[model samples]
Target: MAPVPLTVPRRALDIVVALALLVLLSPLLLFLTVLVRTTSGRPTVFRQQRMGEGAREFTLYKFRTMRPDATGPGLTSGSDPRVTGTGRLLRRFALDELPQLFNVLRGDMTLVGPRPEPAELARRFPPEYQWMFRHRPGLTGPCQLHSRSHAALLNGMPDPEEYYLSVMVPRRAAMNAELLAHITLTTVVRYLARTLWYLLSAAWDRSGGSSGRPGGDATRRTEEGRSLCVRS
Candidate 1:
């Protein structure tokens, strides 16, 4: 696939909105920083190497939601022992990802694009899927939203990287390509609205005392020998 020409106007808008959001959310960011420090102890921010556009590597940021030494293989499960009580709350409310607004501001990410993958995981993707690398990774994208409720269940299982590479990546790539095909102000607004809705809905569910499913039956089926191939 040929690289899509990025629109300067849209990129400028993304930058402006990201910077504004960082400024507006400064107080909340500070509070979360203190909470993480008090709960997880030091290193309020978590940084990890993630594969970016054109297969370049970049450091991604997030609010620390695990013990300082929680690093290992694969993704995080909801029941992971490394997650602190505060961390669970942050994850539930998606507060753990707030720090990525900096990523958006820094040009390392976008408000909407394919979610970045760890370098090791990216290595497992086939060459065709690597086409996703043509665009900047995003803070909130199709795959992130799609997999939001299943992280814990998926992370706990063996070879979960297959789920991300085989299932999530293709779906995300399609959605991202669609987004690029129709990249416009209206689409961006709609994407922003959907992202906000998901966040607010998650917050409401948490406040209403709901235990969101760790994994859906469909996800289980995919894990249980079902093909993860995406239809063209």
Candidate 2:
């Protein structure tokens, strides 16, 4: 398949929205930085290398939620012991990922797209899955949307690494490919709106309120899985 051209309009939207959010959320970002520093110690921001557009590698940033010498394999299972107290909270709300706005600003990522995979992990994807990387990785997208509760799901699994690689990775990659193939302005807007609803609903659940449904807690449980992977 031919590579899709980089979406200039998408990049422009990413830049505008990221810049506006960075400016608007500056105070919260600063407070979170200080909190992470005091709670986790030095290196307020955690940087990890992720595979980016066209299979390039770039440094992805998040608030330091784990200790400097955190142990365990690459996959973070639910409630892994390495997470700091503040890190757990940050991961719960995805505050840790706010730093990636800079990555979006730098053109390494976008507000919505496939979440970037780690370089080594991404390399293991099936050959057909590679095409999903033609555009910048996103902070929110179909993979992220579907995996909202993955951390909780994988928590205490026999081997999170195995399951994530063998099961989750392929499924998410296929979903990403589908999203990429059908990408459009309307689709992007719909995805963005859905993400907002998830965040809001998750926050509402965390506040000890119900949305008047039988599976309300289940939804919250999934949102709690935000930290189950990289940030958890």
Each prediction's whole-model lDDT (CA):
0.65, 0.67
Per-model TM-score, in order, reads 0.81, 0.82
lDDT of 1 by residue, 1-232 (tens): 3444357876787899988988998999989988877775666666666778777887777666655555433566555565668877887767877877887877788787777776666777888878887778777766667555556446456766667567666666787787777767777777788888877787657442111222111121111122121212
lDDT value for candidate 1?
0.65
C-alpha lDDT of candidate 2 relative to the true structure: 0.67
- Tally clashes: model 2: 4
Q: Per-residue lDDT for 18 in model 2?
A: 89
* Cα lDDT, model 2, residue 188: 76
Instruction: List the candidate 2 regions with Cα displacement exceeding 4 Å.
Output: 1-3, 206-232
Model 2, span 44-154: residue lDDT tens: 776666778878888787776666666555656545666677876776566777888999999888777888876656776678677766667888888776544666556
RMSD of each: 9.1, 7.5
